[model samples]
Target: MKQLRANREKGMTLVELLAALVLVSLVVILINSVFLFTEKNADSLSKETDVQQNLLLGMKVLTKDVRSTDGEQVTVEKNRLLLGSDEYAAKNGQLLKNGQPVAGDIQSFEVCRPPKGAVYREDELACKPLIAGEADENRIIVILEGTANRAGKSRRLSAMINMER
Candidate 1:
Protein backbone atom coordinates (compact mmCIF):
# COMPACT_ATOMS: atom_id res chain seq x y z
CA MET A 1 0.00 0.00 0.00
CA LYS A 2 2.86 2.41 0.77
CA GLN A 3 4.59 1.60 -2.56
CA LEU A 4 1.35 2.14 -4.56
CA ARG A 5 0.79 5.52 -2.90
CA ALA A 6 4.32 6.66 -3.64
CA ASN A 7 4.01 5.80 -7.33
CA ARG A 8 0.63 7.54 -7.62
CA GLU A 9 2.05 10.78 -6.14
CA LYS A 10 4.85 10.88 -8.76
CA GLY A 11 2.57 11.19 -11.82
CA MET A 12 -0.98 12.34 -12.63
CA THR A 13 -3.58 9.73 -13.63
CA LEU A 14 -5.58 9.76 -16.90
CA VAL A 15 -8.67 11.10 -15.04
CA GLU A 16 -6.69 14.05 -13.67
CA LEU A 17 -5.34 14.95 -17.12
CA LEU A 18 -8.86 14.90 -18.58
CA ALA A 19 -10.18 17.11 -15.77
CA ALA A 20 -7.43 19.67 -16.32
CA LEU A 21 -8.01 19.73 -20.07
CA VAL A 22 -11.73 20.28 -19.55
CA LEU A 23 -11.12 23.26 -17.26
CA VAL A 24 -8.71 24.88 -19.74
CA SER A 25 -11.11 24.36 -22.62
CA LEU A 26 -13.97 26.01 -20.73
CA VAL A 27 -11.83 29.05 -19.95
CA VAL A 28 -10.81 29.44 -23.60
CA ILE A 29 -14.42 29.30 -24.73
CA LEU A 30 -15.45 32.00 -22.22
CA ILE A 31 -12.66 34.29 -23.37
CA ASN A 32 -13.57 33.89 -27.03
CA SER A 33 -17.23 34.75 -26.35
CA VAL A 34 -16.28 37.94 -24.52
CA PHE A 35 -14.01 39.02 -27.34
CA LEU A 36 -16.67 38.42 -29.96
CA PHE A 37 -19.30 40.35 -27.99
CA THR A 38 -17.07 43.39 -27.54
CA GLU A 39 -16.16 43.43 -31.22
CA LYS A 40 -19.81 43.43 -32.24
CA ASN A 41 -20.66 46.29 -29.88
CA ALA A 42 -17.75 48.36 -31.15
CA ASP A 43 -18.84 47.92 -34.75
CA SER A 44 -22.37 49.04 -33.90
CA LEU A 45 -21.15 52.14 -32.09
CA SER A 46 -18.96 53.19 -35.02
CA LYS A 47 -21.89 53.13 -37.43
CA GLU A 48 -24.04 55.23 -35.11
CA THR A 49 -21.27 57.78 -34.77
CA ASP A 50 -21.00 58.04 -38.54
CA VAL A 51 -24.70 58.83 -38.84
CA GLN A 52 -24.45 61.62 -36.28
CA GLN A 53 -21.44 63.14 -38.01
CA ASN A 54 -23.34 63.47 -41.25
CA LEU A 55 -26.19 65.27 -39.50
CA LEU A 56 -23.84 67.70 -37.78
CA LEU A 57 -22.04 68.54 -41.00
CA GLY A 58 -25.27 69.38 -42.77
CA MET A 59 -26.56 71.39 -39.84
CA LYS A 60 -23.41 73.52 -39.60
CA VAL A 61 -23.52 74.53 -43.26
CA LEU A 62 -27.21 75.38 -43.12
CA THR A 63 -26.84 77.50 -40.02
CA LYS A 64 -23.92 79.42 -41.52
CA ASP A 65 -25.76 80.19 -44.74
CA VAL A 66 -28.92 81.24 -42.95
CA ARG A 67 -27.10 83.55 -40.58
CA SER A 68 -25.16 85.26 -43.37
CA THR A 69 -27.97 85.84 -45.86
CA ASP A 70 -30.51 88.61 -46.14
CA GLY A 71 -33.88 87.04 -45.38
CA GLU A 72 -35.39 88.38 -48.60
CA GLN A 73 -33.00 86.29 -50.63
CA VAL A 74 -33.81 83.08 -48.80
CA THR A 75 -36.18 80.69 -50.47
CA VAL A 76 -37.68 77.52 -48.98
CA GLU A 77 -38.97 74.62 -51.03
CA LYS A 78 -39.66 70.92 -50.55
CA ASN A 79 -36.28 69.42 -49.61
CA ARG A 80 -34.56 72.59 -50.84
CA LEU A 81 -33.37 75.77 -49.11
CA LEU A 82 -31.57 78.59 -50.86
CA LEU A 83 -29.66 81.34 -49.08
CA GLY A 84 -28.57 84.21 -51.30
CA SER A 85 -26.02 82.76 -53.74
CA ASP A 86 -25.55 79.58 -51.73
CA GLU A 87 -28.01 76.79 -52.54
CA TYR A 88 -28.68 73.81 -50.26
CA ALA A 89 -30.67 70.93 -51.60
CA ALA A 90 -31.28 67.40 -50.29
CA LYS A 91 -31.10 64.85 -53.07
CA ASN A 92 -29.93 61.25 -53.44
CA GLY A 93 -28.88 60.82 -49.79
CA GLN A 94 -26.70 63.89 -49.97
CA LEU A 95 -26.90 67.57 -49.12
CA LEU A 96 -25.72 69.71 -51.97
CA LYS A 97 -24.34 73.24 -51.81
CA ASN A 98 -24.05 75.10 -55.10
CA GLY A 99 -24.57 71.86 -57.01
CA GLN A 100 -21.69 70.24 -55.08
CA PRO A 101 -21.93 67.71 -52.28
CA VAL A 102 -21.59 69.19 -48.82
CA ALA A 103 -22.73 66.32 -46.65
CA GLY A 104 -23.34 62.68 -47.51
CA ASP A 105 -25.62 60.03 -45.95
CA ILE A 106 -28.33 62.63 -45.40
CA GLN A 107 -31.82 61.20 -45.25
CA SER A 108 -33.81 64.44 -45.07
CA PHE A 109 -33.45 68.17 -44.67
CA GLU A 110 -36.30 70.49 -43.73
CA VAL A 111 -36.40 74.27 -43.46
CA CYS A 112 -39.30 76.48 -42.42
CA ARG A 113 -40.18 79.82 -40.94
CA PRO A 114 -41.57 79.74 -37.46
CA PRO A 115 -45.15 80.93 -37.05
CA LYS A 116 -46.14 83.83 -34.85
CA GLY A 117 -45.88 82.80 -31.16
CA ALA A 118 -44.22 79.53 -32.21
CA VAL A 119 -42.43 77.54 -29.53
CA TYR A 120 -39.37 75.43 -30.42
CA ARG A 121 -38.74 72.16 -28.63
CA GLU A 122 -36.19 69.39 -28.96
CA ASP A 123 -38.76 66.65 -29.56
CA GLU A 124 -41.04 68.33 -32.03
CA LEU A 125 -41.11 71.13 -34.61
CA ALA A 126 -44.40 72.62 -35.83
CA CYS A 127 -44.07 74.79 -38.93
CA LYS A 128 -44.70 74.69 -42.64
CA PRO A 129 -42.01 76.25 -44.82
CA LEU A 130 -43.40 78.34 -47.65
CA ILE A 131 -42.17 77.51 -51.13
CA ALA A 132 -42.62 81.07 -52.46
CA GLY A 133 -43.03 84.62 -51.14
CA GLU A 134 -40.82 86.49 -48.73
CA ALA A 135 -39.35 84.40 -45.92
CA ASP A 136 -39.41 85.65 -42.36
CA GLU A 137 -36.68 88.29 -42.15
CA ASN A 138 -35.66 87.10 -38.71
CA ARG A 139 -35.52 83.36 -38.18
CA ILE A 140 -35.96 79.97 -39.85
CA ILE A 141 -35.97 76.46 -38.49
CA VAL A 142 -33.69 73.78 -39.97
CA ILE A 143 -33.90 70.04 -39.33
CA LEU A 144 -31.54 67.33 -40.56
CA GLU A 145 -31.87 63.57 -40.48
CA GLY A 146 -29.19 60.96 -41.21
CA THR A 147 -29.46 57.75 -43.16
CA ALA A 148 -29.86 54.60 -41.07
CA ASN A 149 -26.85 52.31 -41.19
CA ARG A 150 -26.14 48.80 -39.97
CA ALA A 151 -26.68 49.93 -36.39
CA GLY A 152 -30.19 51.12 -37.23
CA LYS A 153 -29.48 54.41 -35.53
CA SER A 154 -31.45 57.59 -36.35
CA ARG A 155 -30.44 61.11 -35.40
CA ARG A 156 -31.96 64.57 -35.92
CA LEU A 157 -30.75 68.11 -35.35
CA SER A 158 -33.01 71.18 -35.32
CA ALA A 159 -32.08 74.80 -35.05
CA MET A 160 -33.83 78.20 -35.09
CA ILE A 161 -31.54 80.36 -37.17
CA ASN A 162 -31.70 84.15 -36.70
CA MET A 163 -30.75 85.92 -39.91
CA GLU A 164 -28.39 88.85 -39.76
CA ARG A 165 -30.80 91.48 -40.96
Candidate 2:
Protein backbone atom coordinates (compact mmCIF):
# COMPACT_ATOMS: atom_id res chain seq x y z
CA MET A 1 0.00 0.00 0.00
CA LYS A 2 2.81 2.45 0.77
CA GLN A 3 4.55 1.61 -2.52
CA LEU A 4 1.36 2.11 -4.51
CA ARG A 5 0.63 5.47 -2.87
CA ALA A 6 4.20 6.64 -3.52
CA ASN A 7 3.96 5.65 -7.20
CA ARG A 8 0.65 7.49 -7.62
CA GLU A 9 2.12 10.70 -6.09
CA LYS A 10 5.38 10.55 -8.07
CA GLY A 11 3.86 12.11 -11.25
CA MET A 12 0.89 14.28 -12.16
CA THR A 13 -2.30 12.54 -13.33
CA LEU A 14 -2.95 12.62 -17.07
CA VAL A 15 -5.93 14.97 -16.73
CA GLU A 16 -3.98 17.40 -14.51
CA LEU A 17 -1.05 17.43 -16.90
CA LEU A 18 -3.31 18.11 -19.86
CA ALA A 19 -5.04 20.98 -18.04
CA ALA A 20 -1.71 22.57 -17.11
CA LEU A 21 -0.50 22.30 -20.69
CA VAL A 22 -3.65 23.95 -21.98
CA LEU A 23 -3.28 26.80 -19.46
CA VAL A 24 0.31 27.40 -20.44
CA SER A 25 -0.53 27.40 -24.15
CA LEU A 26 -3.32 29.89 -23.59
CA VAL A 27 -0.99 32.23 -21.71
CA VAL A 28 1.58 32.06 -24.48
CA ILE A 29 -1.03 32.79 -27.12
CA LEU A 30 -2.32 35.75 -25.15
CA ILE A 31 1.15 37.20 -24.81
CA ASN A 32 1.82 36.75 -28.50
CA SER A 33 -1.42 38.53 -29.41
CA VAL A 34 -0.54 41.48 -27.20
CA PHE A 35 2.85 41.80 -28.87
CA LEU A 36 1.31 41.69 -32.34
CA PHE A 37 -1.16 44.43 -31.42
CA THR A 38 1.63 46.64 -30.15
CA GLU A 39 3.62 46.16 -33.33
CA LYS A 40 0.65 47.10 -35.49
CA ASN A 41 0.05 50.25 -33.48
CA ALA A 42 3.67 51.24 -33.86
CA ASP A 43 3.53 50.76 -37.63
CA SER A 44 0.42 52.91 -37.88
CA LEU A 45 2.06 55.62 -35.82
CA SER A 46 5.06 55.66 -38.13
CA LYS A 47 2.90 56.07 -41.21
CA GLU A 48 0.99 58.90 -39.60
CA THR A 49 4.21 60.70 -38.79
CA ASP A 50 5.32 60.44 -42.41
CA VAL A 51 2.08 61.81 -43.80
CA GLN A 52 2.05 64.73 -41.38
CA GLN A 53 5.61 65.66 -42.25
CA ASN A 54 4.96 65.57 -45.99
CA LEU A 55 1.80 67.63 -45.71
CA LEU A 56 3.53 70.32 -43.63
CA LEU A 57 6.44 70.57 -46.01
CA GLY A 58 4.20 70.84 -49.06
CA MET A 59 2.10 73.50 -47.37
CA LYS A 60 5.12 75.53 -46.39
CA VAL A 61 6.38 75.60 -49.94
CA LEU A 62 3.00 76.63 -51.33
CA THR A 63 2.33 79.33 -48.73
CA LYS A 64 5.69 80.95 -49.27
CA ASP A 65 5.04 81.20 -52.98
CA VAL A 66 1.56 82.69 -52.57
CA ARG A 67 2.59 85.32 -50.04
CA SER A 68 5.48 86.56 -52.17
CA THR A 69 3.25 87.19 -55.16
CA ASP A 70 3.38 90.78 -56.47
CA GLY A 71 1.09 92.45 -59.05
CA GLU A 72 -1.41 89.63 -58.54
CA GLN A 73 -4.71 89.77 -60.36
CA VAL A 74 -6.80 87.45 -58.15
CA THR A 75 -9.97 86.35 -59.92
CA VAL A 76 -12.25 84.10 -57.86
CA GLU A 77 -13.56 82.37 -60.95
CA LYS A 78 -15.25 79.56 -59.06
CA ASN A 79 -12.46 78.90 -56.53
CA ARG A 80 -9.72 79.62 -59.02
CA LEU A 81 -7.15 82.30 -58.44
CA LEU A 82 -6.22 83.94 -61.76
CA LEU A 83 -3.17 85.90 -60.57
CA GLY A 84 -0.17 87.39 -62.39
CA SER A 85 0.58 90.14 -64.88
CA ASP A 86 -0.36 90.55 -68.55
CA GLU A 87 3.12 89.38 -69.46
CA TYR A 88 2.47 86.23 -67.38
CA ALA A 89 -0.48 84.30 -68.77
CA ALA A 90 -2.65 82.75 -66.05
CA LYS A 91 -3.07 79.36 -67.65
CA ASN A 92 -4.40 76.23 -65.94
CA GLY A 93 -0.93 74.80 -65.33
CA GLN A 94 1.42 77.76 -65.59
CA LEU A 95 4.04 78.47 -62.90
CA LEU A 96 3.93 82.25 -63.06
CA LYS A 97 6.63 84.43 -61.56
CA ASN A 98 7.92 87.92 -62.24
CA GLY A 99 11.48 86.61 -62.16
CA GLN A 100 13.05 83.23 -62.85
CA PRO A 101 12.11 80.24 -60.70
CA VAL A 102 13.85 80.24 -57.36
CA ALA A 103 17.04 78.13 -57.33
CA GLY A 104 15.92 75.72 -54.60
CA ASP A 105 13.08 77.52 -52.81
CA ILE A 106 9.78 78.60 -54.42
CA GLN A 107 9.18 82.33 -54.82
CA SER A 108 5.43 82.65 -55.59
CA PHE A 109 2.64 80.20 -56.47
CA GLU A 110 -1.03 79.11 -56.50
CA VAL A 111 -2.85 75.74 -56.39
CA CYS A 112 -6.14 75.12 -58.17
CA ARG A 113 -7.91 72.22 -59.82
CA PRO A 114 -9.62 72.35 -63.20
CA PRO A 115 -12.55 74.75 -63.20
CA LYS A 116 -15.69 72.66 -63.12
CA GLY A 117 -19.28 73.94 -63.35
CA ALA A 118 -19.42 74.85 -59.69
CA VAL A 119 -16.30 75.17 -57.57
CA TYR A 120 -17.04 72.24 -55.32
CA ARG A 121 -14.75 72.25 -52.33
CA GLU A 122 -13.88 68.57 -52.89
CA ASP A 123 -13.16 68.22 -56.65
CA GLU A 124 -9.42 68.11 -56.20
CA LEU A 125 -8.73 65.70 -59.03
CA ALA A 126 -7.98 68.27 -61.69
CA CYS A 127 -4.79 69.99 -62.87
CA LYS A 128 -4.60 73.02 -60.63
CA PRO A 129 -2.03 75.74 -61.17
CA LEU A 130 0.73 76.13 -58.61
CA ILE A 131 1.28 79.81 -59.36
CA ALA A 132 4.18 81.87 -58.13
CA GLY A 133 4.03 85.61 -58.75
CA GLU A 134 7.03 87.85 -59.60
CA ALA A 135 10.27 86.81 -57.93
CA ASP A 136 10.20 89.56 -55.33
CA GLU A 137 7.51 91.97 -56.41
CA ASN A 138 4.04 90.81 -55.33
CA ARG A 139 2.67 90.38 -51.80
CA ILE A 140 -0.68 88.73 -51.17
CA ILE A 141 -2.66 86.35 -48.97
CA VAL A 142 -2.99 82.70 -49.79
CA ILE A 143 -5.46 80.27 -48.21
CA LEU A 144 -4.78 76.56 -48.26
CA GLU A 145 -6.70 73.44 -47.21
CA GLY A 146 -5.74 69.80 -47.25
CA THR A 147 -6.07 66.51 -45.39
CA ALA A 148 -3.31 65.00 -43.29
CA ASN A 149 -3.63 61.40 -42.17
CA ARG A 150 -2.10 60.02 -38.99
CA ALA A 151 -2.54 56.60 -37.53
CA GLY A 152 -5.69 55.85 -39.58
CA LYS A 153 -7.18 59.18 -38.61
CA SER A 154 -7.49 62.19 -40.96
CA ARG A 155 -6.96 65.79 -39.98
CA ARG A 156 -7.78 68.87 -42.03
CA LEU A 157 -5.32 71.76 -41.98
CA SER A 158 -6.13 75.23 -43.22
CA ALA A 159 -3.60 78.04 -43.34
CA MET A 160 -3.22 81.57 -44.61
CA ILE A 161 -0.03 82.82 -46.22
CA ASN A 162 0.91 86.49 -46.31
CA MET A 163 3.88 87.66 -48.36
CA GLU A 164 5.96 90.74 -47.70
CA ARG A 165 6.15 93.53 -50.27
- Which residue pairs in candidate 1 have backbone atoms (N, alpha carbon, C) closer than 3 angstroms, thus clashing? none
Q: What stretches of model 1 exceed 4 Å from their correct place?
A: 126-137, 149-153
User: Residue by residue across 1-165, what tens digits does model 2's lDDT show?
Assistant: 899988878888889999999999999999999999999889877766654554455456545645555635434332334445422222322222343321212222333323223232333333344445422223223323223334334533334333335
TM-score of each: 0.79, 0.53
Following a full C-alpha superposition, what root-mean-square deviation does model 1 have from the true structure? 3.0
| Stretches of candidate 2 exceeding 4 Å from the true structure | 71-153
In model 1, what is the error at residue 85, expressed in angstroms? 3.3
**Clash number for model 1?**
0
CA lDDT of every candidate: 0.80, 0.44
